[model samples]
Target: MQGSTHGIPIDTDKSSPIIVDLIYRLKIRDVMTSTILSCRPEQTMQDAQKLMKDNSITGVPVMVERRLVGIVSMDDVINALMTGTMGQPIEKHMSRQVIVLEDDMPLSFGISWLDKYRYGRFPVLNAKKELVGIITSRDIIVTLLLEMNKEIERFEEATSHREASTSGFHLEYTTRRFDFEMAGRLSTETKRQLKERDLPPKIIRRVAVAAYELEMNQVVHSAGGTVRVVYDGNQGRVEILAQDTGPGIPDVESALSEGFSTATEWVRSLGFGAGMGLPNTQRVSDAFSIESSPAGTCVKVTIATEERSNP
Candidate 1:
């Protein structure tokens, strides 16, 4: 194999190749160049060409009955032109010989296959054979670079989370039988962490808002709860757990509604009974789940360090 200009050594000329670790971990989801662009196998070659031109891509996956059955590249088109075939369908010229990888497979196997087989790109699919993503040499290289950076960041963060968790500092608070005063405290703590770590403000805000609402739900309805804050340089997360032994809300759907509250008169006096708690919590969280029972209620909230757009 020929080494890339990027100074990556590859025995490209060899029939059998082994990929190195530096190149393997580059398949990290956050980093990876992929062509989400695809074309149906039955589509005309012209349509396939149009898709490639529009996306500025050299190749496109071929789908049949919504399943990835093959792939077609620019080289296929050239072969058609040279053979006096211009108006053929994609399936007629596309390479039915398909190669794929799982999302969790190490980048090494993918790289080795690519090098040994002389493929420009490969599709990434799950066990269900669903087309989740694509991987190319460029994508692999980019992923490698990103993994290197993320590794350093994770190491730094591990040190910080350890220091904070072991700082021998204890902060505790008690919530009344039914009150929401301490609901925003966890969020405030998370915000402070974001500012201290210089995380993106937009992402921090979303995490904080989500954490606060989850915290408030516990305080307002549950018996009590606690929050543990941790930060690792690349990301920060907050874990909040609230629990109580009370008759849980009968209808989870109504409880999750915006502007829906069942607070008693005394509880509502604190301006804490707005029905936005559950809905707002879900809105701000990257992942949201709930479980409850009549005997007691428990809620857990988590906040990520990175910013994500609402779904």
Candidate 2:
């Protein structure tokens, strides 16, 4: 899917949509196994391998004085054995350049890194850069599954209170300038409201993405804005309206294209502007329209309440 926040477009990956939602909200500490088994750099390669074998694990973090220094995996062990270096210190053969996750980082960040490196597991570090735990892809999958179950339960509960009429609901939120701290707050609230109304998971996911992208746009590029969500139960649809008083997008066509961005270097550094936001919003919404001028920009997105099957 594609969408633009400001002039930057957003793109969604081809992974499972439900899984993406789950991972995007979860922090590493929420899913990581804190009771980690690690090895010291001074430990013999033989000892590290034995520990891994005994625990049925394939990798272990190498530490020095309680701080992470490197990592040793089964591949390292095999190479050591072949080269007759099993007797050497693990530090000698361990991967010195380690890629670690912070405990508070979102699972989505970890997922991206994992996809890039195809690592079996990652060492998780705390604010002090000390190894605190470890996480594997299996852990992420299991956690997401559990979260999905909770969402299902919430849906059931919400549906139990469903009204006979499809009158639906409406909500409005104000966005602030340079409010990076609360960029996605409006979107999160919108998702909560949709869940309370027992909207389908697919619908909720799309609305959430669009709302978030718009919210980010207001915070990152606009002076301020308002996000409004209007759901029509009778029509089985939800519409999102985002209006901002920022300098309007000069080139709407260019803004919709993938990889097109007008964000400053600082915004790019913070990972906010990659030019995929509006395109992603358009991709997920059943209908999308926008109007822009020097005065302001307004975006409207509509999504169906139910998934449509392929003919």
Worst 10-residue lDDT window, candidate 2:
1-10
C-alpha lDDT of residue 305 in model 2: 88
lDDT tens per residue, model 2, 1-311: 24311221124455556555666678999999999898899899999999999999999998878888899999999999999999999999999988899999877776777777778899999999888899998888888778997787577546633632345777677889877876786677678778878888888999999999998888777889999888888888889999999689999999999889888888889898899988988999899999999889999999988776962
| Candidate 1 structure quality by residue, lDDT tens digits, 238-301 | 4445555656777889988888898767667877768888788777665566677987666666
Among all windows of 10 consecutive residues in model 1, the one with the lowest summed lDDT is 165-174
Whole-model lDDT per candidate: 0.67, 0.84
Collision count of model 2: 18
**For model 2, what is the C-alpha lDDT against the true structure?**
0.84
Query: Candidate 1: where is the Cα deviation over 4 Å?
Result: 1-35, 152-311
Using lDDT, give the best candidate's number. Answer: 2
- Relative to the unseen true structure, what is the C-alpha lDDT of residue 123 in candidate 1, on a scale of 0 to 100? 81
TM-scores, each model vs. reference: 0.43, 0.47
